[model samples]
Target: MTGTDAKDDLHQYLREAREALLWKLDGLSEYDLRRPLTPTGTNLLGLIKHVASVTAGYFGAVFDRPFPEPMPWIESGRDENDDMWATAEESREQIIGLYHRAWAHADETIEALPLDATGRVPWWPAERGGMTLHRILCHMLSEIARHAGHADIVRELIDGSAGRRPDNTNIPPLNEQWWLDYHDRLDRTARATRA
Candidate 1:
């Protein structure tokens, strides 16, 4: 299609992933949002923080736009994985606000540059340092979507809520008992095939 149409499509998908990730925070307490539900310490708020850093870097520094805020967690000489989780002092509102701001900044970069406009990713290896706005969009879209899936599982473990989004679950209309039975069937089948 036209250039505008292609850019809009990519932006739309990126927005969808962002919204899905944020929706997981709804109705959750600060404690619940920060609780490490998985063995790897995958918390809801942390995912938001991480994605914000990611988008800000990809769409900002990579494009030479530079998100207007300092991200100490991602700076050189910081503890490894600092961006992967929020500190105890960091409130949900703070992290979420930064995420929203990052979105706005990234949007500015996306709007100003054509999809084929080139830039260098300083953090990337030499062979892959050169990039285009289109490539960054696709990469961020995939990254956000992958983390959104993680948020889905972590959210389900917390409260039994599971869906693509609030308005569109896209899952079968199965009752709790039906789901339990479905899992039971799978369990039995796996057991039967065990070596």
Candidate 2:
């Protein structure tokens, strides 16, 4: 494949992961969006919020194209892991808006620069701070995909919803009883391991 093709494929995958993460929030109430469904306080809105900040930094600051707005939660360190979740005052529109803007900024950077264009990551060790657009893209893609998986689990815990995205469930279309029996078989196998 050509260099451009590789970049496009990577960008497309990143975009899908970003959309999948955001899609998990649809039709949910504010309480449900912010409510921690996992033991580590993982929630739908928080996942989006955290990704926005990280995405902006990697695609914005890393490439010398800064995001237009200030992210005090990430920049100022006002609260620990503030980016990991949304605050009561932060509306759904606001966080989602920021994420969209970050995507635009990242896209511009990706478009303007070549795959080998060098950039420094300030957060990384001095010896390994320098990186290329391709490397950063791969890293961010992995990061977003991992968080998207987390969003999947958190959403499932909230309302028994499970899928790759809203339009694509990507799972076998089986009856409810089939799922329950499959789950039971897995449970029994897990128990048998310790017996």
Candidate 3:
């Protein structure tokens, strides 16, 4: 494939991962969106916030095109995990808006530079500090996809809703009874194998 085609393909997958991550928030109330379903305080809005912060840094600072905003939480000497959860005052709209802005900033960096364009990740260890657009794209893709999986579980716990996106369930067609039987069979097998 040509260089432009390769970059477009990578960008497309990155967009898909971003969409899947954001889709987890649809049809949910503010409380549901910020509710911490996991013991580690994993919430939907917080995930979006964290991704925004990281994306801004990776695409902004690393590429020497800093995002035009202040992010005190990302500064040194701040509380740990500050980016992973939203404050009560931080509304759902605010965090989601920041995420969308981050997308635009990241996209600009991607468009302005080729995949082979080199950059530095100051937060990384010295030996691994140097990186390229291609590497950062893959890193961000993995990061977003991992959180999207977390969101899948958190959304399911908040309500029984699950799947990849709103328009596409991406799961086999099976009735409720079929799922129940499937779980029951697995339980039976585990019980039978118990020492």
Candidate 4:
């Protein structure tokens, strides 16, 4: 890809990943969004919240800039799994809206800065010094993609809904014959193990 095309591609991937993450929350109750998928309390809403915080950190505060809106959890010393689970006081709209706003802020930073532009990550390990906007954008996209995969699985478990975005050509179809074949193999395996 050319320079402009590569930037657009990366930005498009970031947007799609963000959308997929939010899509997992669609048609779900507030209770469902807050429900823990794993023992660590990873939930849909919490993931969005966490991403917002990290995005603000990398694209805003890390660049010696401040985000227009404040994220209280970072100051409240409750960041842990707080992003993965929503509290009673936290509404679905609020968290999702914050994520949308975060995307706007992150996009601004991406637009204004060049890939080679550098910033400090004070929280990172001492051995690793600061990083560039390019690196941070790549890191954010990586993080979003990882979390989006987790969201896909959790969404599937919740409603048996699974497919990729756009054309959804990545999804495979399984008919009743396939199910029967798989079950027959499982039954044979069970008989052999018992024998």
Candidate 5:
């Protein structure tokens, strides 16, 4: 792909991944959002909260602009893991709303800078000599895709739902007997391995 085309592709991929991450949270109740779905305490709302911090930090604070609001615990060193798991102080609506706003702010940064425009990352000065807008955009896209994959697994565990995106409708319905057959296959695999 040409330079411009590749840049456009990166931006499009980022938007798609971010949307998929948010879509995974749809139709979930507050309790469902906060419920730990993995051994490590990853949950739907927690994923959204992390995205908000990363988005605002990388795109807003990195650029010397103001983020919309404070992440109290993150700012105060209450719990580092709070970034990836919901806390009692955080609400599903508040985190998700902040995430949406962060996206808008991040989009504006992407729009204002050309792919080759450079920025200084103060925290990573020793590692990254300087960073291009293209690099940051690509990195954010990968970050979103990574967390979205986590969201996909957690969502499926919650309600047996799995798909590439929210609008996906291509999954074939399975009957109870089909599930039994699938389980039987799994049992056979376990037995063979145990033996």
Candidate 6:
């Protein structure tokens, strides 16, 4: 109903997405967390790392408040895809820590600015680069939530564990056989449509 209410709502959703993205790494070995599950090399830890980098940018540099640390992987002429995966030397705690710090920094920015506060996205064209805090919040919520969904699928592929969150799986409470049968039915239907 009010500006503060809207901001709070957006913040809540963004926080949930961030948590869900991080939860995918729970109970995974280092190999499993970093192993590429998709053709493009999507992995749980990498997803967390990518989101951390993204959040730091949108909520950090975009708002004239750069993340306090230098991210060499994202700076200079580094490979654009370099931030999407973790190096063997990068511990899971490090990536997750970055994400958490990004969250705190981003939160500070959001709380410090009004919804109408303005900033420019350095990467965007000048004509469309101007943005309000509310706009950035919406953009970030969409971006983070999309990656959280990717984490969900990657986690499923890794261990057959499916859920939006640990507590609320958001899937049917059906038995394993039911799920298998459901998968078979979908497979049959998809194959039939190929004719």
Q: What is the lDDT of residue 29 in candidate 5?
A: 86
lDDT of 3 by residue, 117-146 (tens): 999998999899999999999999999999
Lowest lDDT 10-residue stretch of candidate 5: 164-173
Per-candidate TM-score against the hidden true structure:
0.97, 0.97, 0.95, 0.86, 0.86, 0.98
Candidate 2 per-residue lDDT over residues 96-125, each given as its tens digit: 999999899999999999999999999989
Q: What is the C-alpha RMSD of each candidate to the true structure, in Å?
A: 0.9, 1.0, 1.2, 3.1, 2.4, 0.8
Report lDDT per candidate: 0.95, 0.92, 0.93, 0.81, 0.82, 0.91
Off by over 4 Å in 4: 166-169, 176-195
lDDT, model 2: 0.92
Task: Give per-residue lDDT, candidate 2, residue 164.
Answer: 92
Best by lDDT: 1
The list of candidate 3 runs beyond 4 A from truth reads none
Error of 3 at 55 (Å): 0.6
- Residue-wise lDDT of candidate 5 within 38-149, one digit each (tens)? 7888898888889888888788766666677887746764776768877777777788888899999998887877788777666676577477878888778989899998
- Between prediction 2 and prediction 4, the one with superior TM-score is 2
* After superposition, candidate 2 runs with Cα above 4 Å error: none
lDDT of 1 by residue, 1-195 (tens): 998899999999999999999999999998889999889899999999999999999999998999999999999999988998989899998999999999999999999999999999999998999999999999999999999999999999999998899999878888999999999999999999999
TM-score of predicted structure 5 = 0.86
Q: How accurate is candidate 3 locally (lDDT)?
A: 0.93
Task: Put the candidates in lDDT order, highest first.
Answer: 1, 3, 2, 6, 5, 4
Scored by Cα lDDT, where does model 5 land? 0.82
